[model samples]
Target: MEEESMEEEGGGGCEAMMDDQNHNNWGAGGYGRHLLGPAAAPLGNSLLRGPAAGPTADPELSDVPEANGVLRGCEPGKGGAGAIAAAININASTSKFLMNVITIEDYKSTYWPKLDSAIDQLLTQSPGDYIPISYEQIYSCVYKCVCQQHSEQMYSDLIKKITNHLERVSKELQASPPDLYIERFNVALGQYMGALQSIVPLFIYMNKFYIETKLNRDLKDDLIKLFTEHVAEKHIYNLMPLLLEAQSTPFQITPSTMANIVKGLYTLRPEWVQMAPALFSKFIPNILPPAVESELQEYAAQDQKLQRELMQNGFDRGDQSRKRAGEELTYNGSSACASSRGYR
Candidate 1:
């Protein structure tokens, strides 16, 4: 009996050792059924039969804890909540920024006429005050207003009037060389340049229009000549080199900048195109590269072929239309003659 008890104890020690070894190996290599073999089943069964097998009991109910202290002072009858709510309501109302809304109808009926009258008043002011106003200031204000208002017609008319005014004022300043007014004149010129910048797109649009319209050659020639004269007189030749250099650089010229140049050129009127080759050669040599020059010469030669084709097409269409009209007229005349012969 003593031997049997000792063997049973030895067997239990062996199983514990095996369980420990399996647990260590499982930790090292991760848990797997193959690692435990038959050891895990006995250990799991023994734990199931222990005190942990009993069902858990429900927790006892308890009362809520009292407050540490009461409010320092309390009103007997008046509600404090009403005053607190009123304070919140007042805060909410005061938090918003004030905004003014003007409807489109109100703008047209009330604001626009008033605005126009104000502008006219400023424009027609006495020469003393008007002359003192730099061309730059007038132009800047006009452009800003035009942009804000989205008034294309107003913008165009204002620009034309301002250009004419600047021209007239520039001449007047030149005639009556004011000692104190030199700075003012320079400022005015700067402002005029700003105005020109604003109207540049319009100039480009007009130039394309004229080109497409195929205005008379004589009128085109005259306009080119006028432009040339203006460029020479204005010392725009000096400015052109800088503009060319700017063009060659990586920085792109804005539409406004291009418009200014185009409009400036346009204002010089017709004579400028004739002088373009020489002017460009002197100022913007990069534009007339050797390859481009060669291409232009080639294009000139091809121009004759293009012109001939155009002329032939026009002649064919005109001749066919004229012949058809003539035949109709002749047939009508013969019919009248036959009627007269019958009457006789």
Candidate 2:
């Protein structure tokens, strides 16, 4: 009876040990399953294949290393580390790209002054003054300003510069002597247009993208209109009488000078010369005397005859110079020959 009781106790002990072993194996499999999803099945199967299998001697237990490697791959920081690193790198690159973008405020403070100075030089430069304008640098500034959506401000500033310059020109014209009036005014116009030839290209981006788009007007046309309003029209009453008096003086003012003034007026406002104020309409009939017209015609004929005589005189002078040059060359040659031939 004592031996049988001892055997029964041993059997119970064995059963409890098997249950504890199964429980430990289940816990490990459960941990892997929770973290690794379907991949943990092999771990569980290897550990819990049969009740009789020993903890360390099972054939399926050989696959535990591979399963552990897979678990390590799916581990929180270990498995997804490469992807996380890549994401971090992408975010850093994106931030760097955004930092390099040029903002409107930055462009205004840095690049705009270059353009303003260029315009100022153009407006204020004297005759024969050399303005050192860098086309590429100025163009880049304008391009950047336009790209940053600052084109409207650029256009407005340019218009203001031109208007102010023209106002100053008008004052100078008013102060000039009547005989020098047209000549001075024409010189001013020429300078203004010459400066614009340099300036217009720099502002072309603004003119095309902003001015034309928003205002539906051309830059050159606007400049001409401003000239008409601020200069030509403003000084018309002061300028017209002088122009007519100059036109009547045949020997004094050339026909080309009168034509240029008329053409300049027409260019400013097409109808102003002929129709708007009928510039010569009442002037010729009412203001100018008939005796002056007859005298002007006679003076014009005399002027043409004098010009022909002057041209003939110029030709005669040129012929005389050529003959003198030939004579000199012959004398020089003869002297050279005499010296070379041992003649005194």
Q: Which numbered prediction scores highest in TM-score against the true structure? A: 2
lDDT of 1 by residue, 111-227 (tens): 344434444444345333433333343333333223223233443444454445555654554554333233333343444444344334333322222322333223233333432
Q: Per-residue lDDT for 1-344 in model 2, tens only?
A: 01111111212322222333442443325533544446455544434443332233334333333333343322222222232123222234333323433465655666667788888897777768888987667776666556546677778777887888889989999899877887887777667767767777777777876678778988877887888899989887776777766645433555556656666776776656443243443333332334564586676786677667657645333445434222332235776565555423
| lDDT for each candidate structure | 0.36, 0.58
Residue 299 of model 2, lDDT score: 64
For all predicted structures, in order, the TM-scores are 0.22, 0.53
Residue 66 lDDT in candidate 1? 15
lDDT of 2: 0.58
Superposed Cα deviation of residue 308, candidate 2 (Å): 12
Question: What TM-score does candidate 1 get on C-alpha atoms?
Answer: 0.22
**Cα deviation of 313, candidate 2, in Å:** 16
